[model samples]
Target: MSKREMKIKPVIDRTFTDCMEQLQEGYVCAVAATAGCTVEALRRDLFGGDLLITRDGKTAHDQEVSLLLQLKNTTTVRPDPDKETFSYQLKKREYFDRLAAPRKHPKLLLVVMTTSPNQTEWTKGTHDSLEVQYCCYWRSLEGEQAADGVQKPTVRIPTRNVFDAVALTDILDRLDRGEELT
Candidate 1:
């Protein structure tokens, strides 16, 4: 492959990587909320049907693909202020890299959702290694919940950017369309 062709592969891989990280974080949230539920159980709770189904359609439960999409929206960028470490928060880039490795298939969709007002630099270091499609951040009326039900946490959520054009999307599209982007 030419230099341009060589460059394009990494870009596509990185975009897919970002998407996968989002999916993994989503998976973590789904797992945490369910309190150690199995992946299938989590799937049932979130998607209502098996993981194979993608589009929003009839399923065993009223769960919509949109609900599965909520994973992208459920991340908390910071830890509860009272909590010592940001344990529950996902490591965005690392998660993306693991999922986007060569042998893996793009089986799931992912995105970031935040409850903070500013997200200008959230995914800063991972662009070269991951495919972060959509990044969405919103304000929280109440922030950081404690272990008890008393405290509400502030956070941000970024949904999958499958809807539009982004650097990552541009790269993936080019690759998919049999073109090269250096």
Candidate 2:
């Protein structure tokens, strides 16, 4: 990447904003930890998606394959150990269907973020403080069926769906193979 092309702060900062409540650090951490992965995230109010991540081997400047990310951050404000699965919220069926709508973008990246119930907090005690207990993960929305209602239906994300850098790469690989996210 060239010095002129070193403008990655906006993308990361936007991720931070989208992730502030859910307290998901993966939007910045995992993507940063991974190799060859770059994001072009925006702050759109409506219609357009949040983050645009390039497939592996492509930089933020490259256009080999772009995944439109619809990021959702969930939190367990009231922890429930009896809860079998986390009820993560995606957008309304109509809204999601639109992002999933056919257009110039090839793939829509559905990222489901979640964190421990009320455990993480943004540190304001000092000028430069940070939260330390937030956790998040992702899964593909490729094969899931949409809801028949107008409300933002809750999607159950099993603990098994927790995504690591390898998991993220696999999703990109599936896109490369013309396979929908499984």
lDDT of each: 0.32, 0.54
TM-scores for candidates 1 onward, in order: 0.23, 0.61
Q: Which candidate is the best by lDDT?
A: 2
Native-referenced Cα lDDT, model 1: 0.32
Model 2 lDDT per residue over 43-104, tens place: 67354456667764455664465566666665433224466556665556765665445554
The 10 consecutive residues of candidate 1 with the worst lDDT sum are 137-146
Q: How many Å off is the CA of 108 in candidate 2?
A: 1.4
**Measured by TM-score, how close is model 2 to the native structure?**
0.61
Q: State residue 131's C-alpha deviation in candidate 1, in Å.
A: 24
Model 2: worst 10 consecutive residues (lDDT sum): 116-125
